[model samples]
Target chain A: MADRPGSDQVTTLDTPIRLDYHFSAGAAATPYLRGLAEGKFVGQRCPVCRKVYIPPRGSCPTDGVATEGAEVLADKGTVTTYCVVNVPFAGQSIEIPYICAQVLLDGADISFMSLIQEIPADQVRMGLRVEAVWVPPEERGPTLASVEYFRPNGEPDADYDSYKAYL
Target chain B: MPAAPAPRQGRRPVAVVSFAQAPNVRRDTAHNEVELLLPVIGEVLGNLGITKDDIGFICSGSTDYLIGGPFSFVAALDAVGVWPPKSESHVEMDAAWALYEAWVRLQEGDVDTALVYGFGKSSMGDLGKILALQLDPYVMAPLWPDPVSLAALQARALLDHGLATERDFAEVAARSRRSALDNPKAQVAYDRSADDLLGEDYVVAPLRRHALPPLTDGAAAVMLAAGDRAFELCERPAWITGIDHRVETHALGARDLTSSPSTAKAAEVAGVSAGPVEVVELHAPFAPQELVLCRALGLPVDPTGAGSTSVNPSGGPLAANALMAGGLIRIGEAAARIIDGRVSRVVAHATSGPVLQQNLVAVLEGA
Candidate 1:
């Protein structure tokens, strides 16, 4: 190997990233989050397809049309499917062995994932009925987490045929 | 501005004459991006018995996030020594898309030949964290869901829909890695069975370790010459018959996770079904994604067996996935098969974003 001045020395740079960003929730999501703070389930329906999207979207994906009006939906939903969290990860908020479910809220077209507790991870299955257990009013804010997690609402399990399209 | 060149009306025949790529590696501590690309670019043009001045336009594909700096492609151009300032352009997508751009430019008739390349070094940052930034910033990025977890969600959906099983995913990985044993440039190659791969624990539930691609640092280049120029450059050039791309909604929940409808749309537009496909190269980073793409493109579910349509003969992204270059490598690899007189018709696919959200398909034929 050819030698040069400081050839035996190795230098490295440690660049720590620190940056701030402000994101707009957009025309649809701003109102949805605000409604969540007030303990309300807000969604929008596509005028063409007539399918409702919760935590609302500015545009309907299928019909390529804007969803203008907001609709308040029920807090109850059915689990379309779920995955059992067996391994731990960095920056993970939920505890190990927790259940993460794609909950299809009533009157909503698309499902969103959230934590499911008060039920053993093994017992969580598709079509299981559930409802949001919101935080106390004082703790409510502009976050979906205001409804901490979903729990079995004791309603009969939804028929598999109901959410077959969603899965 | 100078007077615009006259554009050709119908499709102009453009053929991939030469292709080359750097050895795939987990981490390249010795060379930076330009250093990794210089030799690959040189070899691709040199092998064709031509110099950079012989090309009319040069285009590259790369991303700034991986470099942790903006305008990284500008420095990558230094590898080609783009003196005299030849016509050039860039896309922040895979080099396959850059090849697509160059092909479109060649259709203008003025430019007889063009060069396309893609490069990336995924070793520099936490790729999982960097990839999360591509999601919807307001609703999804705040949660910071990793790509593996998102792919697992899709995998689970595929399972529930009766489209595939966990064993099927393992088989794809096993076959890909086994095929990679024949490829010297492959980053991760082994003679493992599907059952042995199935014994591994899930990285994210439903996705075993084999389902994931090895993060790679590599570069690849392709030379495109139009019509008679293709005949002048080589004996058998992989002439591009058709090329098209399609993208789905960015919101993960908005589209059906079980199927890749965008790939289907692009394949239809590219006339992938017009003729029997002898060789197909797919850029599926995840093993399960291969099944999804095959179903979308109307190809065989298991793209194995020598007589049938051979898929991923170069071992594919499952062997060495170098971010932006992986897709372009599929193109180069497919072209090499045709150039070597092993195949006549070939189909190559490239995917970007997450879970096969965006797809580009090209059909290359030998004359």
Candidate 2:
């Protein structure tokens, strides 16, 4: 057994454990979330690199340039890769064995992390076609949860090597 | 091509010339990490005949969560007496990574010598549970699987693959503890045999208490100087020829835990296989991990051979594992051997995250 310094302290704990955190409220995702409330999928494009980003970021990771000019995605994309989340976690809204996938919207350089639903877990695979399932027009909020989940598009599977790096 | 950035050319080339550490104990009530580090830092600096003021840069590796606090490294700076505000930086990863950052800063040409340190106090909290946070916070961390259980899973995978046995783990622990007896800084140093360790019960299945590193509270430091400045500072300078690091995917189930491909990739980039490695210091937190790392690095098993590298002459992490600082101490130990003229060339390694998810390797030589 590991040694506890205060072994004699069998008394009830006095201090209640409280979860307190300070998050960066200035996240660029805020406006994107606001866009989702209006039934719009917004993104930003880098002027220099000419790359479009979904769920707009403040700066590009590779070029380190500030993104500019918002653009709307077509609300459709191909599933790059995905996993069946057989396990659940705290603050998770969905049940176990749900699908989480990377969706690469057209004209975007990279894919974004999202949930997949309205599909069987065993059927999920790399390059499995998928599309966004937005929240009710009235219920959308300024968060990634604005989009409820992604559902299968019934398209042919993409080549294994094509999306391998995204995995 | 703009001269390929010129390798940060400067007036001097710096390398880690000397390193030292105190044994990692479970509970360090005898002294705080700062108190523990003061003397060791002084000892390492003294070997190079340099004072705190002589250091142009200072960097450290540590995590605040280890002690249930934030900005722990900031408090540790007091131990080094940075009243005048020296050029410094820190990493939330292992001290070995801090050393790498320092090496990169040295390449900038403004800094000639640097002081690197790492310390951890694992006795304060449930270290296993705290380390679990190092995993993917969304999916894996919620399971609350402690580090031991994950390592056990890896061990079982290795065992099932016919790569090693439970006996191999026992032998590594026994040898580590026994070898640690010669090291004054060792915490769990003992002269026990593999049979004695096998008698103990398993802490986590497939991982006996001996296979797991002792929860140690300790600190370490190393002094580095550039080419001519290093040569002028000591009779033999441990020149760092190459250093590189890589990280694996955060998902534990997604990776091949039985092999540390990150370590192998780091070794390749650090040029560990470029020439003969006379000595090696591997940062394996678990006994079986040492075996896995050895195979990954392509190092020989024997300790006595021309081509065979002596693994963990300072007993490595299995003897006294201080979470944040263990990796940096590996570099310090390997460099110390060069200062003692025991080896001409050596490789030092450090690891972080669950099951060696991230690895850093450095190749050092005596000049």
Candidate 3:
């Protein structure tokens, strides 16, 4: 059964609310941000499970223990998973048909998302070796953009068994 | 619905066995939500010589607006060390509502023990802006009225109608601060007299500096167990005999500000008057709301603490009010007295939303 509006008395109004806030990246990301400023990569190691996390989560996600000891990580890693971006929308910074992937950094227990450039979008695949390309020294600061993007390192692709667990 | 609902007769018995809270502080600069709450959870579970495995269910309450981020409760779960994936739930309101959810789950009989906790940091953001988002979106919230202004309006109503005097508010603050001398976890505690507090300037008419709760960044937790599990863990378990919650009209103009009919209705449903209430804990952030609550609940007042019933021996919310945890702390404070063999019957109340619009009442007893 269906009912249609027959000169019904219903009024519609639009209301909008805006709230501004200051965000802190918290204890784990603070050190990581500092590391980025110096063109260095760092991670936190979970004492309970010994899993190293990049951009260092304050607590070990699996064991829920306060992570200790910042481990310096390599800029090179394997692409555990990836997608080719084709759609264009508002605030589109990069050009279309770019590659974005979850890069499992060397010595990191988990994979993090990043952009892959300097290689054709179609060539980007799972287990591809990649390295961070730093921006100009003047542009480098406390941000992920300091390393403009990841690029193919021209090394042999990683073995399937190495990053299968991350997928 | 059953006419004139009778008291629960054959329901399962649940008791609060252990409780822990982070030391109340104006700001916890070094610790994030995970670190701030980790010790509280560890202490609550460790006090009973148990671990997360011993917990059957987990529930927490908190809002993300404090940090202006989403999934704050999920990040807060890191304090629990959730190995093997425990069954859990969360509420965006006060942790008292989380405890209520856990209590309802316990009534189902499958779960024997549950861990309930709440944490918040008011100093992280503009509390006034954060609180304004909770009002009626179309008509009320747009005004962007801060909480103290709203509480001041309620206080003004109390004064204009002679429901209470300004000195009575001062006395509530003075007695709360004085009683807090023995509480190691209170953020604000002193031996200030009511006459001294009256000397302070008013934040708003009928509301002074001492009348408002401190902006506290803290966390609190409670452990609940049913029947034998509770007795085995706690020497004197505070068995919760009655628990109920009720809500009233959201539009402030449609309701009375000087009285809390929602609290009265909730107290009735929870059977608060069935036994002598030896302790009463109300989550009244402003000192004047305590007078309103006492009037609604029909409880005798002895602010000097010489009478049989003691109110806020833990200094209540006037000492330290952590948004998400304030109400749960009230329940924990009341239960602690019963667990220590200090009291027989206690009524714990928690308020949420605007101007005490929603109220939860629980009656705990000692065998």
Candidate 4:
């Protein structure tokens, strides 16, 4: 054995932190979620500026005031913008060549992101009329997943001038 | 033509006009961060008889790690309306840093008023373990040493080095809790004696339960105005006469835990020694750290005693440790004393990282 007592060596220790969290939604989403549980789209309009917001983001970005008066919205809406997902990556849940569109619901001031289906991805254009295809009532509860996807609503495309401001 | 205002070298006076805080609680189940901050922001602004429109720049301090979401501060903006797009910024550190940014912005003379706010909910996750993520990711964070154990090492250093006694820590906790009786927002407060507190079980060696801060969910907001606008807003504004912040080496082994040189350096630059301190509010999460901070700030180890300056009159962090907001709340508490005319001059210190790796010092005075 070596007589020298001191040696330069790095000792490594393994330490891991596993933390669990209970996620709670903000106050504004509580009511909106209740409507989802009931198979309805609930949104609010800003009190200062009567801009309706489906899936209201607690407040109006333009006015910066809490949205007021829960207003149930229609399942059908117009696509103000859209993007075709053609790139493939790991954990790709959906098949390639799907469409992700920003749908501006009727009576809503802002657009919310949603998937478009039942039509060709290239056919999913701005100003496309789409309706929420909901899961069976038994499978639905307080979640956006309640709606399977927005498909063709068999309605004529609205003129771009009608939803130009949203773009 | 007039020599460009002589190229002002000194700081432009910025006064903290109002401060409001939500009650610190172990759990705020009913309200999220936005809802918790809304009332505090309202009260802070309403205290000055003003609104969001009155603030020129809005700065906030918070970390997304606590919220488990990216860009959580964006949603929190709803509490303080940013409509018409106010000049706003945010920091991932405590709100005291946000106040620092606002102070620097005020120096530009473009923003006459600033609103600084911070909010956090430690009860949402394992605050102890989560804090480890802030350690040196390469070596220290991998060890997952929670904040309490790290602070205990510092406390043990104090004890071993004869810097302080266990009774000193108890006294700090006792005095802090007693002071918290007056602080309505404090999460924990009692009239227990120091000796009794000394008998409590140790959360970590040399650090008793009393010495450790109670985890809290809280939010606080403060308003600052530059020059004459401060006079119009608050009758007795706590003017920030001097402010500075410093950080130590990131490697835990590279610095001395027994003494916080960064805190002392910050105190020096912040002109804490220049004035007669009447109130000193410190963001010391543990009791021993309070002694370290007091000594670093050039105050007595027992700063809580009935001395010339009252230390932690708001119970300090031993009462409520709400992470990102703790430091800013210390500054606000000190400024509140000055605003209330209880003190002419005060020193407020805020610390971040493990065992006071970073420190911020500010001197507020009534003008």
Each model's C-alpha lDDT? 0.85, 0.76, 0.87, 0.86
Q: Kindly give the number of clashing pairs for every candidate.
A: 0, 5, 0, 0
* Candidate 2 lDDT score at position B295: 81
lDDT by residue (B244-287, candidate 2, tens digit) is 89999988778988888988988887788878988788898888
RMSD for each model, in Å, please?
A: 24.7, 19.3, 4.2, 4.6
Which stretches of candidate 4 lie above 4 Å from their native place?
A1-19, B1-9
What would the per-residue lDDT of candidate 1 be over residues B18-121, giving only the tens digit for each residue?
99999999987556676577679779988889877788999999998887777989867756766567899999998889998998899899999999999988
lDDT of 2 by residue, A57-148 (tens): 44443343355677887787778877788777889878888887888876676798888888888978778877788878777776767788
Q: Write the per-residue lDDT of candidate 4 for residues B108-210, one digit (tens) a residue.
A: 9887999999999987888777898999876788778888899899999999999999999999999999999998999999999988987888878889999
* Top-DockQ candidate index: 3
Tell me the TM-score of each prediction against the true structure. 0.67, 0.66, 0.94, 0.92
Candidate fnat values, all: 0.00, 0.00, 0.39, 0.39
Chain A (candidate 2) TM-score to true chain A: 0.77
Order of candidate numbers by lDDT, starting with the best? 3, 4, 1, 2
- DockQ values for all predictions? 0.01, 0.01, 0.46, 0.38
Which residues of candidate 1, in runs, are more than 4 Å off?
A1-167, B1-10, B303-307
* Regions of model 2 farther than 4 Å from truth: A1-167, B1-13, B301-307
| Predicted complex 4: DockQ | 0.38
TM-score of 1: 0.67
Candidate 4 residue pairs that clash: none
Q: Residue B209 error for model 4, in Å? A: 1.3
Which of the two, 2 or 4, has more DockQ? 4
